[model samples]
Target chain A: MARLPPSSGPASPAPAPVACSPHGRFGPYGGRYVPETLVEPLEELTAAWLAARSDLAFQAELSDLLANYAGRPTPLYFARRWTQQAGGARVYLKREDLLHTGAHKINNCLGQALLARRMGKQRLIAETGAGQHGVATATVAALLGLECVVYMGREDMARQALNVARMRLLGAEVRGVAAGSQTLKDAINEAMRDWVTDCQRSHYLLGSALGPHPYPAMVREFHACIGREARAQILQAEGRLPAEVIACVGGGSNAIGIFSGFLADAGVRLTGVEAGGRGPQLGEHAARFAGGSPGVLQGTFSYILQDAAGQIAATHSVSAGLDYAAIGPEHAALRDEGRAEYVACGDADALAACRFLATTEGIIPALESAHAVAEARRRAPRHGADAAIIVNISGRGDKDMEILSRELGLGGAADSPVD
Target chain B: MPSDSRAHSSSPAATPAAAGFAPFFARARAAGRPALIPYITAGDPTLEASRAIALALAEAGADIIELGIPFSDPVADGPVIQRASERALRQGVTLEHVLALAAEIRRRSPVGLLLFGYVNPFLRLGWGRFAQAAAAAGVQGVLATDLIPEEAAEYRQALAQRGLEPVFLAAPTSPDARLAAIAAASRGFLYAVSRTGVTGAREQVPPGARDLVARIRRHTTLPIALGFGLSTATQVEEVGRFADGAVVGTALVAAVHAAVQRDGPGAAAPAAAKFLRSLRG
Candidate 1:
């Protein structure tokens, strides 16, 4: 169990350091599985991250940027109506949607951008699926005055055209990848290839907690503020920790961020909601925990949806942000240890939750977050009315309005009124 | 795991050191010249046509023939090889098909065969099963493009158990410690990446490559084969001055692609043979 400091008392001594296996393995899940060409760069990144972690100046600068630039300490809202609608638990929503760039991705991008600058890298390259990370990366690049390039799958670019325009508007070049499934995985492949060629001058700002070492650990630490703030705020508001914490998992950045706060809290339950897509059939969903096996992809060993021959299988989800074939390595470790539980919500359930949140709470949740909302809706009714649940509303739905409009048959009116 | 011990542990009939490109390197050393190694995507235009192209290159002067097992996602490859892989995948080529093709090629030619591809397909087939099947198919060695030496202990053990060489790559950016580790782990020959980029052709070999080879030579006596961006004969000759072998992949693959477009798949063998001859000179 985690030792918590009293609200009125002086800060307690730091808790005992969590134990991890050498070489960044989370119970045999994560390792450096890249080519020889990338091993040195990964080592460089690992050393830089270790040095930065202890440097007070680096932490102070990052804190300053998070507060002044990306907007830190986003509010924690009490969802009275949502609680009443669920007819059980008292629900709270962590308002990460209020952050700059409209999602939690900026937290990581800003930290990596600062690291890149410190490393004397003049260029930044990233890969995105739903364009939220791309926009966040581009925004930080523009702020830092560094050259930026973002690779998006052609299929994703078509679905998220507004984000493409936003990236270009931010002075970042947007390249459309047309290989493989033409989705997040292919974009990752292209971006890695570019990094292998241009790593001398460029920093590959991985957007999630799913790649090789130092990235999963580094990105998690950058976003740990989300959990840290929420824990303190919730304790102040409710006088104790919530009964459960829930967040949607794609490559599992947001969930990992929130989970980090309560990982040692024995009283808090962690639930990760994955995109179930249409159903449970193969190629119909991105529910990695449901159908995936242990395999390696993009430099990390994790649960991956692959065919019998070990080729990565295609995955689908209405939420572009959650449409991936694998989850974070730590999540796999957490699941195995019974520390965290993973579940899935179908596309229809997610969309219904998105609509419900819009009409009831007047808050349009991103489709990715809607999966969490849907899971909360299902689980809340089973708990007592006094029980508390916190759902991480990871991003705003403005970027997803186009897809929602097309799906809901609202036509171009959805795009016309948003801007 | 010295070379002699590894040779002694495997099947008594199979000389593990002689089964791979070591003999070719020795022969080239005797001839006082660098060996020419050519790479081609298996089942590029078609599997049968790829077989003919491999034999023709070997007959023309290729000391070691590298048959690329086409993968859907090849991050280490540039546009040329990427397109070739896509074309081969479209032809429904699998690892099984590539192994079969290697078996047929071994029957017709004595040239050394190296099966090249990413790690997923091989992992799918199971490393033990894949290594056994590969050695039985007469494959001399295996170069998994994405499998680094650090995470390749089990893979190397399996290959060593089967008397098949486990080849590892060394990049210019590799530190001295890593170079020593790679040299100790790599069998057959050390694949020295000519530059810090994906496999493709360039006008001039990166100047850093020569220094990298010199650094690697201090670590191990294993013959080093320089690859990535060696397209022209002048570049090949320049590499010959310092390295034991020069690997030509993208240029020969481009020739095969051009031949298929111009005179059909039948012309690819002749075009590839002509290109190999020119590079050897």
Candidate 2:
């Protein structure tokens, strides 16, 4: 507790206004701005959540689920070689990749699934783009013996067919949405459609830290356990918290999860790395950081890359997961408050770091995570050798290897190339 | 039951819907026909055109106007509504503009306005602010196409506090108990989704929709409005026979789109009015 930084920023000429409000209002950003019909259920969730917060049983149960089912308390391993190359800044990796289902997604899914079960819901529904969240939801539905249906964009279903098959094999129904662009955006559209039509027995498990109201708050709470564990582990391992903590942002769940632990702390500098793609030019990147305005997309008010008329413009990124047009509401708030700094990493930078880590640290990160690793690698030289930096290794690179090999000219590397 | 007498309900202020409903609903109820609730995408082709379409719908015998605030992904909507949403979004219709249009309509039309939209926009605006603004804009009711009844507390509180009704959908897939739960909490009117899919004209309402409506009736005394696929007069009459109101959206929007394409903006609204009045007749 003493190690945590103070809530307000240290005295500065113009301290960035503390972004988040108690009721999830990040200066006019986050709010419970949903349809009137969903108000009661959101209230129930809030009530249940409030009760769950202090209930010893709920905490213990959540801990047990995290430890046994989700396989949490993920490691923070020292990246010796990567650090040596980084102008001597000691780098450590919080390995969320090694968690069950091979990404940090499962942590939130497990918690949400349990909450759904406790709520007496009989079924779970979700929308998936790259099919990562669909796979994660399917895994939980299988484990809990709950009915699950996932809506995936028809295009994404075709591109990420393997993930679709994996979800189906797990006994969850996968519906390929044939609407709009047939991508993640469309999948979310269809899922919301399903939720409106089938809200009685179903719970819509959102995949990211985006969405309106309870979702941003709820997903953050679930993922907060990640930060909680990491905080305790880091404190136990090192004399104090690291100087800077970094994570890749795609809907920003993993980054927020790690950052929430240090939100009140003024000393820790939180950095969220977005997929810069080809650069900041329109249609070239998905970095809402590099180019975004406060607008509504998905469900919440956040930084969205929209056209002049507030239309969702087409976004591009090497990673399907990070090719979104908006950032999470919390991240948008954090950016506004100056509590965090957002950086954009291009495809070249991420790929370079992916290769660098594979060669130097013997670890392969998801293309999304590689964005943070790339930034850390680039900035490590400036931080000095004694400075400690923490980068969240968000996922195992297995899902990305195929795409990376094809895109990056890695002809035949069963083992990804070293830097 | 007379039109003149209907203007003043015996105890309107005491009742929820009766309290807020005006002289328009009075005449509508006395006519012995269910209210025609026609939905149209605001700005399917253009904002001005959509505004004209709204007026045309009201003139065409629509008692309550369910103006659809188009979303990028309209989940509960079928192909036609999905297409309509796409067209509206392409034309740059936003939630802010949608509410502004409703405010504009309130300035001229006495027709009861109920906004039909996805939850994302309201969520984006923050429920409290959206509800207050919507109520101030003369929106009597809101039908969120995506919000579940169980998660409706904040939205419901905000809407109720603003004197706006938060309407919920009762579908064929819902169980008797779940229908009861939704009906008990719903206000203004229960949006009885005729089928499982999103909003669009269907060949027919599912055989179970009538039973679902009946089940909802048993739970609450609120009026029931049937929607999702009742485009033609035949379906409207069919739904009117049992429900208090019938909502026609996709078909009306389609007509407006067709009229706009054929005769341009000048004739679109009148054409829509003519087409919509045909549904009630």
Task: State which docking tier applies to candidate 2.
Answer: incorrect
lDDT of 1 by residue, B203-277 (tens): 998999999999999999999999999987888889989999999999999988998999998998999989998
Docking class of 1: medium
Q: Model 2, range B37-109, lDDT digits (tens) per residue?
A: 7887787777787777776676566677888888765545677777877887876778889889988776666
> Against the hidden true structure, what lDDT does model 2 obtain?
0.76
List candidate 1 segments past 4 Å from native. A1-20, A412-419, B1-18
TM-score of each: 0.93, 0.77
- Which stretches in model 2 have alpha-carbon errors above 4 Å? A1-27, A54-61, A412-419, B1-21, B43-60, B63-69, B91-197, B201-229, B232-245, B254-278
Candidate 1 local lDDT, A259-281, one digit each (tens): 99899899899999999999998
